[model samples]
Target: MKKIILLLTLITLVFSSMPVNEAVAKSKYKKISVSATAYNELGRTATGFDYRKHPTAKAIAVDPRVIPLGSKVYVPGYGYAIARDVGGRIKGKIIDVHFKTRKQAIKWGRKKVKIRIYRK
Candidate 1:
């Protein structure tokens, strides 16, 4: 069990470091372009994920129709995140990325970005 867990962790780390284009090639997925915004909220997410405590968790809010809930997403500059939450304003191809700090969120602001989505 421990070996399997370790192997899974190792695989996640390795895949996460892979370049965007390569990851798309390796995975059964869809690469999409969307509007991305950042947030640093101090509460539980729609998925009941305690993102405030797990500050390093790469969590994203999305419209389930576009990116299904619990899907893994790769944002170019933001690294890998899971689609775990949703917002009233987050409809269509817009995604909300969570950051550890307000400054980081502000720094990220909003941008048009291409992201790779993988079904978990």
Candidate 2:
């Protein structure tokens, strides 16, 4: 009788834990087109100095539906970008790449690229 009760309790615990694990693993993720801008570190002080702390290169925008804000994405052509800001003009499957310098960013201009979303 005691063994039977213990077995039932253990089974209940195991089943209860499954749903949480599945929800995390099954979090929706998808691929989208990305563009890159490469830039050298400049114009940081002029921007007020806080922005200078991190890499001069910044990721302007990405499709929020495809990649959530604050998520880190790896772009095939453009190294890596953190989904920072969104663009009103940019909608659907498009992303705006940011760079430290206008020269590099413009050089990259616009190009179709692939991005992989890293989920925790």
Candidate No. with top TM-score: 1
Candidate 2 residues lying further than 4 Å off, grouped into runs, are: 1-30, 34-52, 55-57
The TM-score of candidate 2 is 0.58
Poorest stretch of ten by lDDT in candidate 1: 20-29
- Candidate 1 lDDT, 14-107, residue by residue in tens: 9999878955577577899999999998789888999667879999999998899999999999998899999999999999999989999999
Residue-pair clashes per prediction, in order, are 0, 0
CA lDDT, candidate 2, residue 26: 78
Q: What is the C-alpha lDDT of each candidate?
A: 0.92, 0.64
For each of the candidates, the C-alpha root-mean-square deviation to the true structure, in angstroms, is 12.7, 4.8
**Candidate 1 residue pairs that clash:** none
Work out the TM-score per prediction: 0.76, 0.58
Best-fitting candidate, scored by lDDT: 1
